[model samples]
Target: MKPGLMMALSALMATSPAFAYEIGDSISPEVAEKLNLQPGKAAVVDFFASWCASCAKEIPEIHQFIEDDKSEKVQVLGVGVDEDLAEGKAWQKQLNITFPVYDDTDQQVVESFAPIGMPALYYIIDNKVVGKRIGAVNHIDKQIRADLKELGVEQ
Candidate 1:
C-alpha cells in the first residue's frame, strides 16, 4: 500500500464512530458485573458526563421517571463518564440523584457501550440490549416511559 493511501485510511478509521451495541446485542458479562445488573429485571442504563449540558438536563427527568416507577420491574442505573470523579460526584449531588451511579473515571463503561453521542440510554433485559436513545431528548421521562412500555417492561 502507498504511504499516502495508508495515512488516509488511518485518518478515516480514526474519525469513524466506534461500534455501538444495538438491539439484540448482549451486554458483556464484565460490563453487566460492573453495572451490577439484577437477574430477571430489566435495566435502563444511562451514560452521562459532568460536562455534558444535555446530560445535566436529562438526569433530573430520568430521576422523575424513577420516582414515578411503581412496578419495580426495571432498574435505572447511571454511569457517570467524567474523567474527574469529584466533579461527577458533585454534579450528581447537585442533581440530587437517588439511583445508583457508577463513577466511570477510567471510562471503561462508556467505551464498552461506545454511544455515538452523549446522554445515551440503553434498555437491557437478561443481559441483552433491547432499546437505545442517544443525544439530547425532549421530555426524556415520557420518552423513557413509552420506550419501556414498547419493550414490554411494566412501568
Candidate 2:
C-alpha cells in the first residue's frame, strides 16, 4: 500500500470508536434487566471517569443533547467509573448532570468491555449497539444527530 493511504487507514483505525459489548457478552444482571425493560428505544451510554479531562468536556454537550432532543424514544445513561461512588456523585453534582447515572465503581459492568478507554461511548437501538464513539466526538450534537438518524431515531 502507498504510505499516505496506509497512514490514513492507521489514523482511522486508531480513532475508531469502540469494541462494544456484543449481544452475548456477560453484562451485569441489573443492566441486562434494564435493557429488557426498555423494549424499543435508542440509547447513548457514556462511560467516564471523574478525573478524565475529555470526559469532563463531553458532559455539558451530552446534557444539552439530552435536553434538546425531540425524540422520547431514547435514553442517555452515564456510567461513572470513579474509584468511589461519592466522588462520582460529587462530580455529577458539580456538572449538574440530571440524567440517570450508574456507578460502576466495582468495575463489573465495565469489565464486559475490557480495554475500553476512558470516555467510551455506546449508541444502541432496539437493544443492540449501533454506534460506539469510544472517544470524544467533535461537534457531538451533529454526530448524535447523524447516529440517531441512522437508527431511525431523531433527537
Candidate 3:
C-alpha cells in the first residue's frame, strides 16, 4: 500500500469512536414502565447477558456504584438479555445484587440502544441518553464517574 494511503487509514482508525453504541436512543417501553422512571433524574441502564463472562465480572462493581450513589439522582437497572427468564433470575440471584433487573430477552432495548455488543452501559438524564459504553473495558468506575459528571449528577 502507498504511504499516504496507510497514513490516512491509521488516522481514521485513531479518530473513530471507542465503543460501538451511542446515546439518545429509545429504551423499551416496558423497561421504562418497570423501572418507574420519570424524565428528571439520571439512570444507568445496563444491557447484559447472564452467561457473558465480562458481564459477570463487571456486575459487582456496577452494583457497588449503585449502592454508593443512592442519593435519588441516579439508579442502575440490570436489563438481562437472556432467552430464559428463569436463567436470568438464577444469575441475578447468584450475583446477589440489590438493583432492579428487567428482562430483555427479545432484544428490544438491546437492539435499539446497544446493537453492537454485550455489557452495554447507558447513562441517561432527563429521559435522554448522555453517554454510553460498550463491552467490559477496564476503569469502569472512572468511566461512570466521568459520565455522571457530564450529566451533572452530583454526589
Candidate 4:
C-alpha cells in the first residue's frame, strides 16, 4: 500500500469498534459451515477478492496443492472478500478454482481477520490459526508440506 493509503487504513482501524484479529483466534462458525471448512485438521484459509491480482495468481497454486497432496488430512478454503458476488463467482469459474469459497460480501469474516492485505493465507491446525503468508504464491506447496510436517499433521 502507498503511504497515504496505509495511513488512512491505519486511522480507520484505530477507530474501528474492535481490535484487529491476531493469530490463534477461532475461525467463525458461520464461515466454517459455509465453506465446509475443515477444522481439527491442517488447513489453509485464503482470504481473497476477485479483483485482487495476487489472489488471482495464488488461488490456482493452492488448488494444485490440493491435487498434489491427495490427502484428507489437509484442506484449502477460499474466502471471497469482493462485494460483488457475481464478479467473485465469475472469477472463480474463470480460474476453474477447485476448492470451496466462502463469500464475505458483508466483510464480516474479512474484517474479523483484519489488517488483511490481498491474497492472505491463514495457516491453521486443530481450528486455530497458527501462521500466515500474504502475497502472490510461489512456494505454497512447499510451505504447506513443511508446515503440516512441523505440525505433525498427516498429509
Give the top-scoring candidate (lDDT).
Answer: 1
Specify the poorest-scoring 10-residue window by lDDT in model 3.
Answer: 17-26
lDDT of each: 0.90, 0.74, 0.74, 0.76
Candidate 4 least-lDDT 10 residues: 30-39
Clashes counted in candidate 3 amount to 0
Q: Kindly report which residue stretches of model 3 are placed more than 4 angstroms away from their true locations once superposed.
A: 1-21, 25-31
Greater-lDDT candidate between 1 and 3 = 1
Using Cα atoms with residue i matched to residue i, what is each candidate's TM-score against the true structure? 0.87, 0.76, 0.76, 0.80
**Sliding window of 10 residues with minimal summed lDDT for model 2:** 17-26
Model 1 clash pairs are none
| lDDT digits (tens) for residues 9-125 of candidate 2 | 999977653454763344445665643425567778888888888888888888888888877887888888887889889998998888888788877657655535778877766
Misplaced by over 4 Å in model 2 are 1-30, 34-37
Candidate 1 regions exceeding 4 Å error are 1-19
Tens digits of per-residue lDDT for model 1, 60-132: 8998898898988989999999898998899999998889998989887787788889899999999999999
lDDT of 3 by residue, 1-155 (tens): 99999999999877654343356655456546765566767888887887789888888888667666756777778788898989988998898867777787766556556447778888877666678888886767667877788778886
RMSD of 1: 2.9
Q: What is residue 83's positional error in candidate 2, in angstroms?
A: 2.1
Per-residue CA lDDT of model 4 for 1-155, tens digit only, reads 79999999999978674744467776667645665766566778888887788778776677778888877887888888889999988988999988778888988777777844777888776656778877766777777777777768766
Candidates' RMSD to native: 2.9, 9.3, 8.4, 6.2
